[model samples]
Every structure is written in C-alpha cells, then in structure tokens.
Target chain A: MARWQPHASERLVAAALDLFEERGYENTTVIDIAERAGLTKSTFFRHFPDKREVLFGGDTLAGRLADGIADAPAAAGPLEAVAHALEALGRETFTAERREFSARRGAVIAANPELREREALKGLGLTAAMAEALERRGVPDPASRVAAQLGALVMTLAYERWSDPAGHDDFGEAVRQALAEVKAAG
Target chain B: MARWQPHASERLVAAALDLFEERGYENTTVIDIAERAGLTKSTFFRHFPDKREVLFGGDTLAGRLADGIADAPAAAGPLEAVAHALEALGRETFTAERREFSARRGAVIAANPELREREALKGLGLTAAMAEALERRGVPDPASRVAAQLGALVMTLAYERWSDPAGHDDFGEAVRQALAEVKAAG
Candidate 1:
C-alpha cells in the first residue's frame, strides 16, 4: 500500500537529479532517490519505472505534441501544423520556469552513455508521434515524415538555445528563430 | 596470441546473423558466434567489442558517407552532395550482392529493442557525420544540418525500398527516387 503524496513525481525528479550530479548516475540507487524525495520506494515506482526514467517524462511530451498538431488550424500546411505543435510545447512543457532544470537535465544525460541512448530513442519516438499526428490530418506519407523530421530539428535547435545559460530568449522566441533558419536553409 | 584469420569479420557477422535468427539474440552468445564461424573467441573480440555490435558496422557507414560527401564535386549543392554520397553507398556498401544479408540484418534488428536503440543512435551519428563533412566543404551551419536531416530521411526511404524482398529496384534507383520525393516534400 502506498500513501498519497503531493508533487511526488517532481520531488523524485529533483532528488534524482541532485543525487545523480553529486554521486554520478551509476553510483546512485532507487532507494537513495526515494529517501531523498521523502517518499517511499513504492511511491517512486508509481511515478517512474526505474531510476533512469526519473528524468524522462515518458509519453507525456509526445502526447502533448500530437494533440497540438491535431488541433492546429485546418488549413495549416504540414510545416505550419508542426510549428503550431512546437509553439504549444513552449507554452506547456518548455515553459520559462523550466529552463534551468532542462539545462541541467541535458547535461546529466549528456554525461551518461545509457541516458544518452535513452534520449536518442525518446527523440525518435517524438518524431514518430508528430508524423503520425500529421498523417491523421490527411498529410500523406513522405510529406508528413519530412515535416516531422524538420520539426524535430527545429525543436532541437530551439531547445539548445532556450536551455543555454547565456541565452535570455524564451522557448517561443528560440523556436521562431530556429524555424526561420531551418526554413531558409531548406 | 591471436593468429591472422582470412575474412574473419565477415564470417563472424554472417554466423552471428544466422544464429540470432535461429535462436534469438539474447539466447546467442559471443562464443556461439565464434564457434559457428569456425573462429576463436579472440577473433570475435578482435573485431567487435560486444555481441550487439556484431550487427552494427561500427562507424564504417558513417565514415563512408562523410568520405563520399567530402569527395563530391565543388559545384554540388548541399543536398546534391548528399545525393552523391548516397549514390556512392549504392555502388559500395549496399551493392546488389549484399541486399539479402542487409534485409535479414534489418529484420533481426527490427525484432529487438536493444538493436533498435543502437540503430537510432547510429542514424544520428550518420546525420552528424554528413553535416560535418558538408561544413568542411564551406557549407554553412543550419544549411548543412538541414541538408543532412533531409539526406537521412532519403536514406531511410531508400533503405526501406532497397531492402524490400519484393522490390526489384537497385539501391541506386531507390536512392534517386527517395531523393526526388524528399525534394518534393521539402
């Protein structure tokens, strides 16, 4: 039996990040994270499958992107639909308040091979999710896939800038700038 | 002491693929692969770092793509350079003789999660390699990256067609067609 805890997931994530930075990802344990979060092991498991998953939001981000694309203007072109979804991400997931945490998370994942692999797989999933959303909107095969890939590139570039410590731009601005550069380059 | 073995790497890869298809990847061991190839475990280690790597060419494909891009004509644009590299892949790595083996390898990889993750990461590496090669050719930042991304998509589409058992087209034909479709989509 597990007791209800407020913000258990967020607490666990923050605790895991702290522990991972302090003692390294491999040196830390699930129990250590749970204890650090002031929650039991079961409560931690309820939110995440393993220690590695603490930093990843599972399918939440993918779902949000898909919904955003689905809800884009009916007449929007493929890339425009993708842009709408990315803008939605800025307002929702990549909010300004999450900038510092995202930068730290990126650094931690970059330092670990396993985390890097997970990140790579997660990225593919996000691209697939966006492509599927486009397809459901009647956007056709290669076009939908192409749009998703370009959209993903835009997101990556925007994320790099948004999460940079020296950069002061919001996620939306970063996304717009990246989208313009990608459009020009394409 | 390790003795020089003739075509040891190729033999090991073939044996590993056969064993993986017959008994599954997890059930097969490095020793089984070596023995099946009539080679010693030392020969296997000399070629690959682990069992998972037996299916992956370990940066060989990336190196080839980069080399091809670097060797492209000075008059070629970024996407044209990528097309040139992909055509080279058809003449070299994805030759007709290797089609059956590549198809089987892709099937084996698609059946397993671990292999899929490795494949995803390898894809990112290939994209990065092409981008760097383009940059060395004086192509700018976002342009190089965009071209690489589109090139990767073309390669993926070409691979799907080239590796299809029922498809009669050559790898070069597939590359040309995919490149055209990607251009249209873009």
Candidate 2:
C-alpha cells in the first residue's frame, strides 16, 4: 500500500508530522521530512510545495465537500446536504490514526501565529467555496450564506473538539452535538 | 472633550486611522500620528502601546461583548443574549466614521499575512471568551459551543459585509441578515 503513488502523499504527511513533532515546525525542513519518509527532496516536493503545506493537505477536502453538497439528493435541504458532505469527508479525513496527527498539527498551528492565520484563511476560502457551491445549486440569498456560515461554524467547533484531549468525541458526533445544542437553545 | 483621558484614546485612534490612510499602516509612525492628533508622544503612548494598537483599539470589544452576554436579561436565550451583546458593542465600537476606517484596516490586514493571522487570533480569543461567558451563565454543553461559534460567525459575516462597498447595510443589520439566512437555510 505504501508503494502506491496515492499513498505516497500520505507517507510524506506522516513523515512530516513525525518530524515536526520531534523537531519544531520551524526546525524541521523539507529534506528532513523526505529523509524520514525514505524518499528524496524531489519526491517530497512532488507531493507538496513546501513544508507548511504538509499540515494542510486537507485543503482539497473543502472542494470535495462542495462537490458532495452539489451532488446531494434532491430531498436533502441545503444544510442537510452540506452536513452529509462534511460528515463523509470527516469520516475519510479524520480517521482514528489521523486524529492524533490532526490534533498535533492543530496544536502546532495554534502555537505559530503565521500558521494559524494561514489556517484561518483556508477556512474562510472553504466557506466561500461552499457558498458558491450552494448558489450554483440554486439555493437563494440567505440560504447560501447561512449554509456557508453554519458549515464553517460546525467545522470550527468540530475541529476544536477533535483537537482537545477532553473532547473525546469524534468529529461527526461533535458536529451533531453542536447542531443539537443550537436547536435545543433555540 | 479631547482633554479627557477617555477622549484622548479616541483622538489617538482617529489620528492613527487618518495617518494610516494617508501614508499607509507600515509607513505611518507613532510620532506622525501623535502630531496629527495635536498630542505629545507621551500622550499617544499613554493611550496606545504602539501604532498598530491604534488600529485595533477596540480589541476589548470582545471582552465587553462577553460581559454583555453574561449579563443579558434572563428572557433572552443564549444565542439571543450573544446577539444582543454583539449589537450593543456594534453601537458603541463601530461608529459610522469607523466603518470606512474599518474597511481600509481590513484591507491592510488582508494584504499582510501577519496582520491577517493576528486578526484570526483576535477572533479566536473573542470566540473563546464568548464560550466561557456562556458556560458561566449555565448554558449547557452544545448550547455554549453553538452560541459562541454562531456569535463569531455572525461577527465575521457582519465585518465582511461592512468592509465591502456593495454591503451598504449597517453592522447590526448585516448580523441580523446573517442570522436570518442561517435560519432560512436550516
């Protein structure tokens, strides 16, 4: 499985995370990550543009989630459609092993102000993309805005929970709980 | 009016915003702002820690907003309480003249990655403060999370609208629209 090209990216990420944990994000270079992954710098560069990108490999998750929302069954409402897409992505992106890595990556980003800003920009971009996707689906004014905003909020809360040790629940469960909380409060 | 200590801070902020717009945030120095405000450097320093702090003079808006949420009347639920608090802060902090300054400041922040990260950090801090306030008010698990997350989302959306030329609506109105949109989508 590790020999495959598709898995190569994952291997680079795993290696980068390990190196980042061992040495700080600033201290860990592309060569170090590549060496740890048993690959060369060229292979590492082939997968990611830079060391910072390894932590953000999940960038494509937003586009995929948008596609899911767009392709959702007609019966599903906008929020429901977006949630379904996010849940599917959550399952695939934040697996048990990946949760540990994800938590570590989040902590690293939080500690580094630059990384944290980049992460926020990425989140904002995803929200805009989701909004565009909803609009394309003919979801009108406030529906598109609401879906995008709510989706981003859910993601923020879910990520917060997923990153915290006290928050033992899975991302999907956390999102569900957050939504339920919103309804109950209302 | 400008002789008062409270008014001095406002004056310094006004001067800084003027200088920032005239010269740019990077090029505008503390001395330049102090001169523009017709105040000594000592007076300027007393009001703000530095030139950048002037642009972000309302950093305490978040804490004030949190306090508002904490102290809202029992009739309002958590979300309503949070929304009311935000509205109150908008009335006080986001004046008509401040809107134009805010739009320019947002552009400055957006163009610079470091400034953008600092903005994100401030936003995260505000959200955490809101969450803590809600928790203290006996808002349970998901309710507290959702209230805080929604508060942040509404704030972000409102700021986005207020910053855009086409988004002529007031901050409070923008927030209301964002909340309505969410409800409509849901």
Candidate 3:
C-alpha cells in the first residue's frame, strides 16, 4: 500500500499556512511558499492569485453554498434551505481529512486582523448569496433576510466547533444544531 | 427663535458623504471634506481619525446598543433584550433627525467594497458584544451564541427597512417584526 500525495492546491495551502504561522502572513511571500511546498512559483499562481489567496483564494465554497440553497427543493423553508446548503457542501469542502488544514488556516487568519476582516467580507458575501438564492425560491422579505444572515452566522459558529481538536464534529450536524438553536430561541 | 448650526462632526460627516458620493471614496481627500464642511482640516481630524471614519466613526451607537442589552431587566428573554437594545439606541442613533445623514452614510458604505468589508467587520464586533452581554446575563453557550447572532441579523434586516426613504419605520417595531418573522419560520 502507498501513501497519498496531496493535491497541488492543498500542498500550497498547507505550506502557506505553516509559513504564515511561523513568519507571519505579512512577512511570508509567494515564492517562499512555493519553494516550501516543493513546487514552482508558477504552479502556486496557477492555483492562488497571491500568497493571501493560498489561505482563502477561491469563491469555491461560497458558490457551492449559494448553489446548494438554490438547488434545494422548492418547498424547503428558509432555515431548512440553509441547512441543506451546508449539507450539500459538506461532503467535499468540510470532510474529516481537511479538518486539520482548515483549523490551521483559521488560526492563521485569526492572527492577522486584515485576514480576519477579509474573512468577514467573505462571510458577508456568502450571506448575500444565500439571501438571493432564497428570494428566488419565493421566501418572503424579512424571513429570507434573517435566514441568510443566520445562515452565515451558523457557518461561523459551526466551523469553530467542527475544527476544534477536542471534538469529533460533523459539519452538517453542526449546521443543523446551530439552526435549531436559533429557531428555538426565536 | 434662533437656529443652531449643526455640530462640527455632523457637518464633517455630511461633507464627507457628499464628497465620497460625488468623487468616489478613494478620490476624496480629508482636506476636500473639511473645506466642503466649512471647517478646517484640523477640526475634521479632531473628530475622526481618517477620511473613511467620517461615515463610520460613531462609537455612540455601538456603545448604546451594548449598554442596552447589558442593562436589560434581569428577567428579560434574549429577544426581549435585543428589542431593548434597539429601543435604547433608537432614541439617539436612529432618531428621525439623523435619518437622512445615516441613510447617506449607508449608501456611501454600500458603494465601496472596502467600506462594505469594514462594515461587516464592525457588524461581527457588535455580534461579539451582544454575545458577551448575553452570557453575562446567564444565557448558555449555544443559546447565547444563537441569540447574539440573531441580534446582529435583526439589526441588519431592520436597519435596511428603517433607512428606506419610502417607509416610516420604527426601530422597536422593525425589531419586533423581524423577531416575529423568525419565530414564525422556526
């Protein structure tokens, strides 16, 4: 049996995170990350636009979340819609094997205020995407609005729990639990 | 009866919004806003740390919102506490007299992705403040988390309705409607 070699994008992301943690996000450069990953700088750029993107490069997750909600059954309510979106994306994006890198990436972002702010912006974008998807399904104004924002919030809260080393967490279950908590409180 | 001049800060905010809207946020300089406001650059600097702050430099609103939640009567539920926060700030932050300026400020923020990002970060900060206040009042982990996030979400939804020029929105009423909508969905 042979061990698996990480994908190029994953290799770059991991290398970037380790560099950011050790030398700081600002001090680390693209070339350094590429060298550390045993790949060329061109290979790095082919995946991420910049050193920072190595951490949060794509609209990949955000797009999936939006598409998930839109692709859900027409009859799903706002909360149910959001839960479905999370579940749909969980199979690939939040798999157990990715947990350690995700946590590391999160820690790197947390340590840098600029990255934290960028993360918040990405969070806002996802919420807006959810709102648009739900509105298209004919969920009413404020309900769609509240659900979208809550959906983003659930991601934040759930991701934290899911990535915690002490916990064996499921992304879809965390999302469902978070939505239930809000529904119960509301 | 004698009419009073608007406060220096108000003039600066108004001037900055006018400039940012007309010339774009990046194109407008601090001196340009100061001149438009009929104030000196020194006076503008005394009020706001930077030109961008003109639209977002108010700790007054955030403080009142947090204080309201923290000061809510001990027996109040989470939703009640949020309603109290909005009502408490409504007297000043969302007053009819300030509506025009606030709306203008919102438009300026919405037009610029960077400002929008900063606003999202501020929104996260407010949510954190709400959660801390709720926990102090003895709300538990997931409950407090959901409530705090909902508190922020309600603000985002209500503020949009409140700022629309066509609507005669009341802050407390908007909050109640938003919370009711969520509870109904839940």
Every model's DockQ: 0.81, 0.32, 0.45
Worst 10 residues of 3 chain B by lDDT: B1-10
Worst 10 residues of 1 chain B by lDDT: B164-173
Residues B1-186 of candidate 3: C-alpha lDDT, one tens digit per residue: 223345988788878888898999999999999899887888888888987767777666667777899889988998679778977766767877766777788888998987887787778788888887788788887677677777777787678777878754576666677667666654
TM per candidate: 0.96, 0.75, 0.88
TM-score of chain B of each: 0.97, 0.82, 0.90
Candidate 2 per-residue C-alpha lDDT over B5-74 given as tens digits, one digit per residue, 9 for 90 to 100: 5577778877876776677777888888888888888888777777666766665777898788977998
For candidate 3, the docking band is: acceptable
Question: What lDDT is reached at residue A180 by model 2?
Answer: 56
Would you list the rank order by DockQ, best first? 1, 3, 2
Sorted into a CAPRI-style docking class, model 1 comes out as high
Clashes of each: 0, 0, 0
Arranged by lDDT with the best first, the candidates are 1, 3, 2
Candidate 3 ranges with C-alpha deviation above 4 Å: A1-7, A40-42, B1-6
Per-model chain A TM? 0.97, 0.86, 0.90
**Candidate 2 Cα errors over 4 Å, as ranges:** A1-9, A38-50, A96-100, A103-118, A156-186, B1-12, B23-52, B96-117, B156-186
Better of 2 and 3 by TM-score: 3
| Model 2 RMSD, rounded to 1 decimal | 5.0
The sequence of per-residue lDDT tens digits that candidate 3 reaches over residues A1-186 is 222335988788878888998999999989999899988888877787876667786888878987899888887888788889898766768988888877888888899987887787777788888888888888887678778877776777679878888754677777777777666665
